[model samples]
Target: MDSTDLAADGWEPILAAALLGAERAPPGGPGPLGDLVTEADPGSALLARLALHGIHHLAGLDLAADAMEPVAVREPAGPECPPAAANRLYALLTGGYATRERLREWFDLAAAAGMRPPAWLHQALLRHTQHLPETVGAVAGAELDWLARACGEDPAAAPAASDWTEGTLAGRRAAFADLRARDPEGARMALEAVFRKEKADIREALVGTLWTGLSEADAPFLEACLDDRAGGVREAAQRLLPRLPRSLYASRMAVRATTALVIESKSRLLRSATHELVVTLPEESPALARDGVEPHAWEQRGGGVRAGLLRDILARAPLHAFAGHPPRLWIELALRSEWAEPIVQGLFSAVAREGDPAWARDIADLLAEAYEGKVSGLRRTNELLGRWVQALDLLPEPEWEARVTELIRARKIEAVLAILAKGPDSFSERFSAALIDWLAFVIRGSDDLRRDLAKPYVIGRLGERLWPGEDIAATAAALAARLPEEEGGDRLRQQVMSLAETLELRVAIRREFQP
Candidate 1:
């Protein structure tokens, strides 16, 4: 017979025999011919074989000869099975099965035949159905129940090589962790059913996985474990319960925190203003105040009973209440908490305002250190510049120009450009000239913005003041020298040449000076 025909006829029996033989070998143990089976053991070999047979029979492949090997092994007197048999069995289970339902049925038969499916099979099922919610729902309950029972069973009662222990739990935990990303609900259900009954360490291992698919439905199960005999298990559940959605316990904790009014400090500085900073729930409050919720003011209290109590309050508060609160409040609170520079800078533009002198000055210094030469967000740089300009205007014109010159000296070219772009006409001609000087500095310092300076608005403003024709081409040549060596350089040179050609009178005089 042709190899194709032989393959069609013999593939099923060969596949089934391989699975059955492999299932009978030890898990993670060597099979016959040195093939490694993930679940290496005799029982696993039987399960693998059973599943292979189910798959072959279901697909109309004849497995009569293949079935005999496992049958003979199971019978009263059979030759010792080779380890390769187990490898063959799992190969069959994974190779040709189409639907998860078929896999589950095969798994059920494998379990009945005293073989355990590899932990990866559970993970595979969860991952395949993540984007297919209906399929996840269809198989989740059944899969979870099977996993729970398999995990719960006493390993001692199982065949010697098939027994599971702490080692087995570790493997299962790893598998469940992977499963959590795909089917958190199913993973939780499987773990929840056995969490309390598991050993203390195992319970912690299981609850740690809860963070993956954590939701309101899982809360009650987690809450019940808060009083678990194991301290670690209780603490883990305690840590996670507060994060669940609309948790009544969390709500109650928040209410208890906000409602209890204690006045421990009677000092003037501590109780400076009776601003009546109202704390109202978002859904219960009017629309205007709805957006006005601030971080709990009491969070400012330094350590001792006051600080500890405030931490408790903020911890339990509805996260959604704080979600719409201004990011500025968080920055202010973070500053009070003595947070680092990056944290302050990350939220600086969001909360720092033009009118707040102390905040504005601090942010300006921060911008100088970190933002110079970086391609910063234009809107953010402009806002800061607006504040700086306002601060400069408040100073005398001499002082204002001095400060602008200081900024130019510091090479804050972008901030300088932004300030000049927005500053009023009242700014002195000396200051405007200083700004053109800053533009020249920018052309020398940064190739990209120099090209920007060649634009009509920027060029026209510079040209109007920096008069005396000879000065123009010197500026253009200065800009041209800074251009990159690529197409951008070509573009920059073209733009500069165009500006020079248009202002020919200035160019001719400057050309004489160049020689």
Candidate 2:
């Protein structure tokens, strides 16, 4: 009630009686004392009424009602989330450890179930999802645009596409590719018109947009880019040209690759030939420069200029141009030449571009053989391991899993990471079950203090990749239950217990979403 309402409700009269001496005025104003029948004096009655109204006044009895009506939220068209799922959301929101990740799970489940968080959580949910860009589509179907708008966000609206030229370099690059997809010719023309006017970096980035609808159609325009003022632009064109078949740029690269290295084999009678590479650095020319043979003037870090040139040729050359050698033979030759780094980098790029599974496998196999044994060449070993991972990524799913298994047996921590990698987007049930089993063994029921602090990180990365089973939670719980018996075990026990809770909560989350 407002001050006026409080006064009008007989408080003013009671105040008057008190001020003018209640013995004279007889404290008879309508108040909490009105119904009392005892012969209590008016002063005592005043104290009684004062006690009642003081608490009421302190609790906002004098506050006026708000003038504006709150924006009424529309009732969700779909049913509200089950109380259990809502509880799960509240737990994730209020608790620590993989909160956002678990919330992502809840968002997916709720969106798929065609349900929304209870009205009370709408504000919190909006605030959280707004900050997590990855959660954009996870809750898209949750129908929370009205809530977003009430919070001053126009979630239902997208900005109109501005003219590409008017946008920042990054924005233009993003929009140009989209434009290229929609109108390839127009996008090229747009790039061409601004090619001379934009900064070298902008020109280079704009040329990158050609990668979107890259084909022979874009080759002529890209070839013209080879002679652009910016060397970056020329190199960008050089990289893109090889992606288009039968382009003169690719043909030039093929000729370079075919002639760049000669294999001379020395053999004994009735014996296998031992091959050696006859490689020499060719002098630079305008043609080589235009094709980005030396992409930069700075000397290559891992290999010299010649090695860089060879890597470029290998990256762009047609597979058949390298003496018809198998991937292994090619790798052997590169290794013999001591250009292994260049070759690996180049071949990895080419394999990805061509999506040649056979080449990827052979390259991965050769690189992975005695991979960790290169202790003397740690940097080189890491580079090669990374190459193996990339190549394996390109392999078919079953083959990828098989290789992951092999890596796990080698007891590679990197392998474990690859196996337990945040997933369900690509990981299979068989893969997850085996990996989780491996994790329990690897961690040794949280007894592995060497890997102690890392437990949460690994477990949190699960992203719901586990197979349908309550075994992991049970194991963690049992370990947590027993840890207190050991000295200096509280922290480890707590960590293990959290893992158990996360797993159990995940199981419940999955259960809540099931039909």
Give the TM-scores of the predictions, in the order they appear: 0.30, 0.64
In each prediction, how many residue pairs overlap at the backbone (N, C-alpha, C within less than 3 A)? 34, 0
Per-model C-alpha lDDT, please? 0.47, 0.66
Give candidate 2 regions above 4 Å deviation.
Answer: 1-79, 87-100, 111-119, 128-130, 134-138, 141-144, 148-156, 159-213, 226-242, 265-269, 281-301, 316-320, 367-394, 406-426, 441-469, 472-505
lDDT of 1 by residue, 384-464 (tens): 445445434434445546767788788765666655543343435456446546665766655667666555544443432
Candidate 2 deviation (Cα RMSD): 8.1
**Residue 457 shift from truth in candidate 2, angstroms:** 10
Candidate 2 lDDT at 381 equals 52
lDDT for model 2 comes to 0.66
lDDT per residue for candidate 2 within 277-331, as digits (tens), equals 6666555677787777765555467667777777777777666565366787666
